[model samples]
Target: MRLKRNPTARYPETGEKRTVSDEKKRGGAFALAQRLGRSLMLPIATLPAAGLAMWHTARLSRRRTTGALMISVALTAFLTGITEPLEYAFAYEAFPLYAVHAILTGTSLALVNALGIKDGFAFSAGGIDYLINLGKSAELSGGYLAGPVLLAGIGLAYGVVYYLLFRFLIVLLGFKTPGRDEDESDLDTFEFAAAAAVAADRSKQKVVHSHRRA
Candidate 1:
């Protein structure tokens, strides 16, 4: 996300709240720190999902369970680092739910910090490798206390809030959740498609021109 500089919020003599240059520097530093955190979380959190998947699919001998669980877990971990998915998930929801997500996300971060299972992954807890790393570290961290708490808290937070918000949104706002149907915005999809088409056309034309010149 682009950080906006509000001159009104800045020190007047400095002629910037956060000057473009200063903001760029800060952004760079934040990005680097985020990457480091993701690197650390990578090996700390993988085993639970693996074990659960194995148990659930034990009779089937299907690796799909493990693979799917791994991918889902990884994505969730990555979202903790990069929050656009989380942000977008609730962007259309009512204020209370959005507040809950924001508070919960921040609290989750704090809890993770408090557990001493800090993620130094390049990405947030929003990806597969990070979760795998998290699982590994969790294994070494004396898993009984911290492990159960993390798993339960995460599941409860996600399940309760998601179900309640989804119910409220669909029943009240008439918005669609995963299983439901409702009016959807075509503008974003159309614009993206149009942009891609334009880009492709331009690229093809450039290639044609280059060939003709050659």
Candidate 2:
């Protein structure tokens, strides 16, 4: 009684029934995004997050609040390889950036491979995993540490690239990233109101204490 043009599947977002064929037909950037799946981003462990944070600072020199928050996130990623926070920040909202990120990730993998760099196996690719893979008994400097060092070196370069590209694209196209959106402004206004209320309360308490003293 029923037929399918393509394999019937639930949409990744809404759980509605659809076909890959139908998605492909829609075409353009969204299709490409769906094809891309998730970013295979590396050093989300450090550089990428740091790049994003630096971009925020680059725009507003005195505003270091976003920078500090991102640095804390970078530390989490660097130590444990928890990258979701940074990845989700722009992935859904900006397809072009996401595409660039995926390409950069692929390039990093290829470079490491072309250099005959041995990808280490462990719980993750973070600093903790890097150190753990080096073996707890190993010395500070040795042949065993070579691969990780190279990987980290490459990561540093990638981070610089990320910072430049992200800064340029975000500014040029006005793509919202972190502290660049209205949502942040709204939140800032709410915080100001809350702080003002607290200050007024404190002032009232001081006045009451003075009257009591009188």
- The prediction achieving the highest TM-score against the true structure is 2
Q: Which candidate number has the best lDDT? A: 2
Name the weakest run of 10 consecutive residues (lDDT summed) in model 2. 32-41
TM-score per candidate, in order? Answer: 0.38, 0.57
The global C-alpha lDDT for each of the candidates, from Candidate 1 onward, is: 0.38, 0.51
**Candidate 2's C-alpha lDDT?**
0.51
Model 1 lDDT tens row, 49-94: 2223222332233334333433443344344332232233234533
The residue pairs in collision within model 2 are none
- How well does candidate 2 match the true structure in TM-score terms? 0.57
What TM-score does candidate 1 reach? 0.38
After superposition of all CA atoms, the RMSD between model 2 and the true structure is 17.4
Clashes of 1: 35
